[model samples]
Target: MRVGIAGGGIAGLTLAWLLSESHEVVLLEERPRLGGNVKSVLTAADGGPCAIDLGVRETPVEVSPVWRHIAAAVGVSAGDLVATTASRVVLRKHERSPLWVSAADPTDTARPVTTGGPAYRAMARFADESARWETEGMSWDVTVGDVLDSWPLPSTAVRHLLCALPASLHGCTTDEVRSLSARAVGTTFTPPHTVPRTTYLRSGNSSLVHGLAAGARPARLLLGTGLRAVRRAGEGFELVDSAGAVHATDVVALALPADHALAALSGLAGAGAWRTALKAVEYREVTYVLHHDPYGMPENRRTWSAGNTTVDGNRSETTTWYGPSLGVDLFVSQLDHRAGRPREELARSSFRATLPTPQACRARQRLGAIHEGQRLLFLGHCTTPVETQEAAMASAVAVAQHLTPCGKRLRDYLEGG
Candidate 1:
């Protein structure tokens, strides 16, 4: 079969790699690059052998079975993984609470985010229940909002702190937290607060991205050209390119985002249900900042090596440090969702990450409608309902299992085998 994959993100790349073995593959990327948001930048003087990821930094080890397998296959082995050693947390509150104290400082007078108080109990209960749900094989019909409403102690500010897990981690606002599945909230690989910091590939995710690209080695890799249109070509699909050329294929797997995929299929046949599902998916955009400012930090100091979250109306902000230990004195701040910090003042520019909501999960479940009348497929965070690398890879694998001749065998052959 002739397989064409739209979007060269992790999902699209994985799909192309999986299907390429059994089919003639074409990987189309709207951007000039292949790894959608897996961007790594060198700060150690161009090619000086040091860099930092401006996006998708954390690579939680336990949660990334699929990614790890693929990475190893592509030669980006386990040895490339690096872990951060910051367990101390600094707490800064907007309301009436303890001032910012260094958790790492032995003599500093700061309290942990969890002091066995109401918020701690609430968080503990949330984690415990999420684990229970996982063990019991239960359906989380309720949202994370419901879980917060389950407890009625402290203040809204404190509740916002609890709500940040879904908002900051999952990508939504406090208002949208009610739309996040309770199960997803409870069952995430590593709840952010407990770990203090997250694990990452020491070399950055670009290595993993490059590995997949090399493994796929698509026969025709289209970069820097956007898909202009998509329509039926007899029994198969014809993808019109930006320069008004067309590439017809036996099968098309749309590994694009819901919006991008929907637009590409504007006049294509069998796109009705797919369009509807794509339209139903809701997303929140966040501005990610890498800077030296400690405005959001406790005492404006580097003591808060770990990210700290604060609530603003329905939105929240998290500050994470890429400090001296990490080879810099910069802090990566996830400014309020959909909002940007001072651009001219800060030395850093803003980057964005997609946040999935409960509505997105609903849309994700409805993707069967897209598959009903079309061989054209969907993948990525839009399909998986979470904006994590593992989720994106899992969605790719799931779709690959359905479309390829021996996809099951190929997927299992993880080591770039």
Candidate 2:
């Protein structure tokens, strides 16, 4: 079969790499750059030229089996990965002492999340119980904030601690965390005790992107060609590019943001229900800025050798600590949804921030219904509605298993993810 994939991000690239062996694949990228949000750059530091990841800084091993498989398959070995010391701090406002934290992995650190006090304990109890339903198909009928409000929350400090992690991890504010569903909160966040030390590609995240493209050379590579529209064409599909060109294929997998995919499919007669379902989920824009100075850091200076930190409350945006996540000393800061532009912005790019609300879960169900029926499939952060490198790879693997001959084995290995 001839396959056409739109949006050359990790999802599209991974799908193409897996399917190219058995099918004729054509990967189309809307951007001039092939690796959607996974961009890497080289900059000068005290040690000379070093790789700085502007997007997707790392591929954490403990939670990312799919990521590790791809990294190894792409020739990125354990030796090439840089692990963090796992030390983290929660510098909340109006607090005398900083709440020290570390990744859940068995790592030695000065401070642990358990020391956050009563509120932290209450939040962890809720996380532990709610996270169990994660595998049992937890209902996404309500927002996470609604559930928290009903719970016996200890104090504002604990509330901030609980919400701060997911807010910072997924690029939303504490308030926005309330808008998301409990299912999403659990999937996006694994309490600090479960959090493992993330590993990064020595060269940068983009190395995996380049490696995938090299491993699977698509029949046609159309860069800077964005999809403008998609309509059913006879037994297959017809795609119209931003350049006014037309292409037809037997199968298509949209590896794009939820909004963009829905927009492209708006005119399709079969996509009426799909557009409605997709519209149910809300999307926010998040900006990641790469800079030299720690403009967003706490008044007290911190080193990159330490892990990333989260500022609680409305000020809940800061650097995810580029130094440790990518083995570089640069700082990559995340701004709250619709926050003012950064001042020391050396590089900036906007990516979609998916809200996993009750409505979103319904939308996801509807999307999955469509996925199960058609040759056209959706893959990416929005599909899983969990923004992480592991989520991206996991979604791709799921779609590949459905379309591949050895799907059973692929499913067996990635099902745990």
> Which one wins on TM-score?
2
For lDDT, the strongest prediction is 2
lDDT, each prediction: 0.66, 0.70
Pairs that collide in candidate 1 are 73-415, 73-416, 179-358
Q: What TM value does model 2 have?
A: 0.87
| List of clashing residue pairs for candidate 2 | 104-193, 104-195
Report the lDDT tens digits of candidate 1 across residue range 35-129.
87687665552235555676777766565778767777778866677656443332334543432222433333454434456656666667778
Q: Tens digit of lDDT per residue, candidate 2, span 4-88?
A: 7898998888888777767787777889988887887777666877677766776557778788777677667778788754445
Model 1 ranges off by over 4 Å: 45-49, 85-113, 136-141, 170-172, 188-197, 293-295, 300-303, 324-327, 336-355, 368-374, 405-417
lDDT of 1 at 406: 65
Candidate 2 off by > 4 Å: 93-96, 103-116, 191-195, 300-315, 322-328, 336-345, 369-373, 406-417
What's the TM-score of every candidate structure?
0.84, 0.87
